[model samples]
Target: MIEERNPTNTWIVDDDSIYVYGLKKLISIKGINTNLSHFINGQEGINALKKANENQQLPDIILLDINMPVMDGWEFMNEFAKLKPQLGKNITVYIVTPSLDLNDIHRAKSIPEVAEYIFKPVKISQLTEIFSQTQYQTNERIRQYGT
Candidate 1:
């Protein structure tokens, strides 16, 4: 039997409603229990993150979209850079975009907070792997420090 993974607080920051719903469903279908939150744009996402941080309820992972109407992913990242230190917790962020532009990929890679740059229509296995890796990392940290 597969080991049940720990539930994660996951945030989806994208302008596309259909993509958001589909992604959420895929996450659930993979049996990766998640307390999910959605934001239609980067500004909204940043605001939510700030509130969550204030309550000490920041998400474990954030799926970020590059292109949006207001405050695109890059803009959000710029703001996030300023807010990150105040957050007091390490939150992993993945850049999810359909763009195959090398510049975009390079830019994302340059950012330290971006854990991975995923192409459009993220696969179930990819998400599972991410969860598994995160779980393993968490377990290791706990084992080492008893946190």
Candidate 2:
């Protein structure tokens, strides 16, 4: 018998509506099973994180943008670091930005929570790989921990 898996919970924390729209389209085209959610700014993302934590429904992955109107990605990282201990689940964070600054890349790498730094216009292949790995990890955790 084949075992069915739940859709991966994913969040995009970006203020660029166009970018978000395109990313969502790509995910849709790829036919990835993800419970996707979007936040316009870092503050909104943080608020959603708090609520998700309370409900024990935290996202499995987050795509974060550096430049936003309220609370940049760095600020959100700070808040996330503080709240992370309370969240029972592991959430992989990827810094997705248009900025080509070396400092930004270095900063993202330095953050322990950040899994990778991806440039703008993410490809369908990348999304496929990410979701595949995330699903594998989630399945492993469930197998081992029965969570």
* Model number with the top lDDT: 2
Q: Assess each prediction's global lDDT (C-alpha) against the native.
A: 0.87, 0.92
What digit string (tens of lDDT, one per residue) describes model 1 on residues 92-111?
99999999999999999999
For candidate 2, write residues 1-147 as lDDT tens digits. 776787899999999999989988888887888988999999999999999988988999999999998899999999999998999889999999988999999999999999999998887778899999999998889888888
Top-TM-score structure, candidate number: 2
In model 1, the number of clashes is 0
Cα error of candidate 1 at position 38, Å: 0.5
TM-score per candidate, in order? Answer: 0.89, 0.96
Candidate 2 local distance difference test against the native: 0.92
